[model samples]
Target: MELDLLKEAFDRVAKKQKQSSSKTLDIVNQIEKEIEQAITKIQTTSNHTSVLTELKDKLNELAPMNQLDSNQKDINLALAKYTKLLEKCFQPDISRAYRNVDTDPHVLNEIISTHFYRQGLFDLGDCFTNEAREPNAASLKLPFVEMYQILESMRERDLEPALAWAAKNRGPLTQNGSTLELKLHQLQFVEILKKGNRDEALKYARTHLARFAATHKGSIQKLMACLLWAGRLDQSPYTEFTAQAQWEELAHELARQFCGLLGQSYESPLEVAISAGVQGLPTLLKLSTVMAGKKEEWQNMKQLPVALDLGREFQFHSVFVCPVLREPASEENPPMLLPCGHVLSKQSIVKLSKSSTRPFKCPYCPSEATISQCRQLHF
Candidate 1:
């Protein structure tokens, strides 16, 4: 409903702007025509007074300046109405005290520097580190610098650096089950074949792609068929191998593999976390408003009041929910598993145990277990 109101207001503003432009353009064209006629009359006629009087009469009839003024008024009125609608639809800020997740300023600065380095902004990262007196920034920048250089080369269709990196990290890449090296060689082979170098492409494939034949036999067979078409690979049965988009895809895969080998993620963790938080902020702000009257109840909440369904992409780890309390388990209230395989929060265990003296019944099962038998589970 709010989006509809916003869209309606936006449409009104856009319509008003277009109308104002059209009206101004029409008036300006009319004024120009009138001025041109007045100039022509002055140039041709000996009676300047009569020509000037006729020009003044034409100007009065056109009323171009008045038309512009009326258009401006319409535009301003539309803008004012749109602005009023925006103000009505806007949600006020939900002010709340910060709780949970204490972060060190130094560690945060390091993370920011690492993010900048990962983005190929060495100068900016260096400046930030120097200004903040961050040590070990150079160590963090080195690996990313090499990765960016290889990525840039890949963007230009050069695969030498990436091939060399692959060769150096062959053991780890193979261990991780990454087909990046084979994919890079396949791209190179296709590039050669596209240039009508069939024999050269075959030799290149034998030297590089042949190694992966045992694992990727089907892929190798497809590439081998591309040899028949040679320069006409685009029209061949294996047209997917000749696509320009494959190079882009391979470059991204190489970057992912390179980062993975270096014990890093392709995207910065800080970036992912912030993106997920921003996506959930609207829901959080709405919850804050609804729970405004219950200050103490929510202010002390270790977990979120409502579950933010951020989809699978943002779900990086497992989260246990205590069935008894109907809340997500946090560090302060961790999930404890009984011998019978039922999980409940530590607080719930305490409540059901009757102060540790009696046995507690598992919510999901009929089995009873003492508090001492329950073990904490980690995500």
Candidate 2:
């Protein structure tokens, strides 16, 4: 609803701007036409002073200044309304939401350097690390450099590099249930068929795509059917195969697999953190404002006063809600695994054990255990 209002306000401003510009242009054109007529009359009548006076009189009579002022007023009013609407919709002072926390400068620099490398900004990464005196922080650049090279080749519609890399990592890729190799082969087969080479496409499919038939029967069948429409896929039912998005998705998948193999996330860590922070900012800002009087409590808080819904993408790990306490575990009250395989928050276990001085039975089972026997579980 807010977005709709903003869009409507923007439209009003745009409409008013266009109307004002048109009116101003019309007034200027009229003045120009009158001046041209005066110049022509002067050229014919040899009465320069009279022609000048007439042009001035005509321009004043048209009331161009008043017309322009009226148009400007409409646009200004629209702009003012739009500005107020924007200010109401967005909070500009994000600093109120900020909390001071100690961060390792080296770790922060490394993340920034890695983010730049992950983004394929090798020169910028190098420059940053050099300036920061953290050359080792750019160590992650080599793998990303190679990944970018393969992606660059893929962007040019040349899949040889990517195919070779996929072939080299075929075992690991297959172990991970990745069909990147098969997808790459499918793209190659399509490229062959697109060149009006049916025999080559068929032979390529038989050699490259046949191996996946046992597990990917449907996909293999689809690729085999695509051979029937060689050279003119656009006219065939397989026209979607020729879309540019296929290559884009393939590139993304390849990058994901590459990052997975490197024990890294597909998204930059800094990017993910920043995105999640942006999503949670409004809530944090509101909380901060409401707790303005309780600044010390806010500063001492180990967890946010309220839950921030950062969506599924930001949920990197499973959250354990203690059955006994009925609250999610936190760093101060982490989930503990009992011998009976039942998990409960440390706080709940302590309470049940009477501060570890006694044994307590598992809430879900007949098994009992002391707090000393329980192990802290990390997500």
Candidate 3:
């Protein structure tokens, strides 16, 4: 476009110099005539003008970088447009969210995480056993398996005694145990960490840690996650472990976060034990897996220090790790979750409609958290 315009301007200048003095006035008249003819031709054009339009667009797009103000505006505009495109392309896919539960014998968190892990929507796959393998993923147990599932459910609820009984009764996995239990029940004794009470979870963890120590590496990771969840860096041995037990890297972070959680959570070791030990571990495993797999999600998980701290606050309060979306509007009150990804008081749930906001912002995520994000991930 500039090239064409320059050529036209040069022609006009050259023609002006050659014109006679009398014709110099005609030069103005001639230029005016040409400009009028150009405007008329533009108004009369009916055929497709794609080539001219595209050329003009290309020139406009090639704005000079020396115009710093314009350059910044264009960059900002491009970023906003790109972000909108990403949100449109990657909105969460909940269609298959619960599709596998009927057959998989897994927690709801797992279903959501595994399906969306690749897309960075959620992550249950990252929840590793002390062995560093995905926990009870395929439900491959037999015989005492049914008992294990009950134990898992009880553990998910932080029911220490119930979980312990299942662990002790079923005994260790190496003692020639049978493997005919249904899918959910097949989760092994390591699920002890899936309990809410660290004391209860430890009961099972110590037993499994000792019994399965030789064969299963996951026992240690389970123990560590439980210990971390229990808020017991000072007490429980939280070894650094992950897919391969990188204790050195994880220990300092664990200790630092433990102090933070202890200061903020406001709960007892027993309370922390139960939440992080049993209910919380499973939730963490699932939630972290989902968060870690995503490109920018890990920071969001980091920002959720308050959520970790809240577990400490609920001493004597039973911490429930469930995978369902509903908070189970009990007989006493309806369901409600707080802005920080925790549950609201029953009174709050009952009066939520009267509250000022609709679809509130979860202090946890960049966007408003759905009830789905708050779903508990039971053992």
- For TM-score, the strongest prediction is 1
Q: Per-residue lDDT for 1-379 in model 1, tens only? A: 9889889878988998899999888888888888898889899989989988998998899887788888889889988988888777765453443345688888888899999998889999999999989877657999889999998998898999999999999998888888888888888899999998999999999999988899999999998988998888888888888677898888888878878877888889889988887787778766766777665456567777677898899877888878888888899999998999888999999998886768878878899999989999988
lDDT, residue 379, candidate 3:
17
Worst 10 residues of 1 by lDDT: 91-100
TM-score of 2: 0.75
Question: Which 10 consecutive positions of candidate 3 have the poorest summed lDDT?
Answer: 178-187
> Order of all candidates by lDDT, from best down to worst?
2, 1, 3
- Each model's lDDT: 0.85, 0.90, 0.40
lDDT string, candidate 2, 1-379, tens digits: 9999999999999999888889888888888889889878988997789889888888789998899889989989999999999999999899878789899999999899989999999999999999999978878799999999999999999999999999999989989999999999999999999998999999998899888999999988888888788889888988878889999999999999999999999988899889988999999888887888665546567678687898998888898989888789899999999998888999998888886668888888999899889999998
Q: Give the per-residue lDDT of model 3 (tens digit) for 147-202.
A: 33443454353334333443453533214342211111213322333343557656
Candidate 1 lands at a TM-score of 0.76
